[model samples]
Target: MLVEVGASARLFGGLEQLRQRIEVEATAMGVECIAWAPTGTAALALVRAGVPDGFASPLPCILDKLPLETITAVASHQGTLQRLGCRTLGDVRKLPRGGLSRRFDKELLTRLDQAYGLRPEVYEWVQLPETFSARLEFQFRVEHAPALMFGARRLLLQMSSWLAARHMGVTSFTLRWWHDVMRAKTAGTGGELTVGTAEPTQSVDHLSRLLNEHLAKVELQAPAGDIELIAARTIPIQQESKSLLPDTIRQGEATWLVLERVQARIGKAEVVRPLLAEDHRPEWMQRWPGAEEPRPRSAPDPCQLPVPDWIFEEPLRLAERDHRPIYQGPLVMLLGPDRVEGGWWHRVGEGADAQQTNVQRDYWVAQSQHAGRLWIYQQRLANDETGWFLHGRYA
Candidate 1:
């Protein structure tokens, strides 16, 4: 961006004076952008990384030899400025603008144009919202804790009135007081406090109660002379319900309040509900402090597929009685005998390749007479080799 200063640098008390002004304003308003002051009318901006500061000087040919970095560095010292392979503005000037466009970003061109004063640039300071903010202009500072506290209280009263007008309550805010060495005895900084919630609050009395609870812990770093109290943040009061609630629901409100208090004290993460995970991975399913509604379940109609009541978290070892596998377990509901077979096309050793991962899965729904609901299955090879395992269970 190019910023055009109509008058010469000398008009603003010279370059140093203007720079200081910029720094002060920027610091106060948190402006960290780069800027430059050049002597020119309807300045010309060209982005060349290695160009010297005097690219715009009496030497017109210097423009051809100047590197864009020289112009950019004088404006903003971005870390990437040093990484470009070009050595100087002269080197950048030697490169074709077409290739330069492909290699470097548009910012380089913009800064170059801005440095020569060819482009238009403007900056506006941020504006604060209209709210309860009281500023004190002190001719002579009053630097005493009690005096500052008194001023703060007056400002707080103003804030309270503003809140009352809006029917709102402040939950958080910061106070800033300018310091002058001439008036105040002590040089002190103000402090901040976190105000607790007010039960369905709109009254100044309730807010004061919350503030007082925190005021006891607030301390001053210096003697406050001039004070400004600002309503930094606020919360709206809950709207009144048109219908009345029974005693049981009111009790539920109390319980909710208790839970909120606990969460506030211990942190929100400590209280949770279990939620079902969408992924097929077993460990990924289920969350603590779970969902409000229970999951739905239904039995497969026609009973064609055997369903199980419980599936082992992991498949267990069984003692074989003969060549045929002997099933001995406190089983639950049994499910499928669905057969899956097809990894023959998979490439061996390519773990994720579908052709390699292709294998047959025989699903079953089985219920142990003693155990609850379970879904177990046996992995069956195309050649009929089988291994018993558990997969899922109904809750």
Candidate 2:
């Protein structure tokens, strides 16, 4: 036998409208349903599990006073006695029907008879629609971080429970960042960061943490862009193996989120991943901070030698001796006296000015004897007052 129940849940309209809407939906599904008092336990019990054997149709008695033990005895007599925990009707049938009345009440017997189809049980089922949506408009354009955070948090809490009851988790959301138009037809500029979760999670705290991390790094061009949050996806959670180390690994995500927040506070240009350039020339080979984007990760070339951690930010001037800088170092490796030549096109028109600003440079690496460290440089011809300038130290 098939049984179904529909419940009315209003999003904006009143409860009666919700109930009537549910009844219509139930009728379409071909199942009779009803809306009992929200506080009525008997109605709920029957609606949830269905009327059991020897119960009256449309059973209308409190649950505690039912003759459950006596109902079980009758089932036992029919040789269908089966223990379904302590709640089976077989136990009820075994009890003396008169004693049942004397000890408690007739509600149990009435419900049981109805459950077994001994009497007709009809209910009007109301079904609630599957979706809930809401929107809010701010009177003033909001550009502050706190304002955006507060608005998103409120929406997250509401969607969280509604999603949970459906045994689901939201996958994506949209936050519209906007402002009023300053000129004809064109709206003020705005941007959005579309984020996705590594896994499905419904916890408001979890969602908030992730979103907060991403938002922290985002810089709004306008100080007064309004914000809107919307849920875009959801899915059910089924049984799965529990994590062996939930607590330990869980904080890693939180850590990343915190870092993102810090980056937001600091200018994004300030936080960078350093990458080493290949040239042995001090300035040429030294690492640059904050490369534009994440490069594809690859293993270091085994053939390439590892470089020392410190490379000079500014080259040092060495003492001169006979036009050439006095070199005092254990010659370990002559990295480069590599030539750099360019800017002749601009020099053609600018003459001496371009020559002064864009002169060619030749770099070299000199090793020190006192400390086994590498020093970087460029060779200068003495005629132009050219001299080697130390750029980096590789130790």
Residue 248, model 2: Cα distance from true site in angstroms: 8.3
Q: Rate the local accuracy (lDDT) of all candidates.
A: 0.50, 0.53
Quote model 2's TM-score. Answer: 0.43
lDDT of 2 by residue, 45-155 (tens): 434444332134324333333433333323333332233333444455456778656654455555555554455556564443476454445667666544666666666
Please list the residue runs of candidate 2 whose C-alpha ends up more than 4 Å from where it truly belongs after superposition: 1-133, 136-151, 157-203, 210-228, 232-255, 276-292, 299-306, 322-324, 327-372, 378-386
**Candidate 2, which ten residues in sequence have the lowest lDDT sum?**
1-10
Best by TM-score: 2
Regions more than 4 Å wrong, model 1: 1-164, 169-231, 235-238, 241-249, 252-256, 288-333, 337-364, 377-387, 390-395
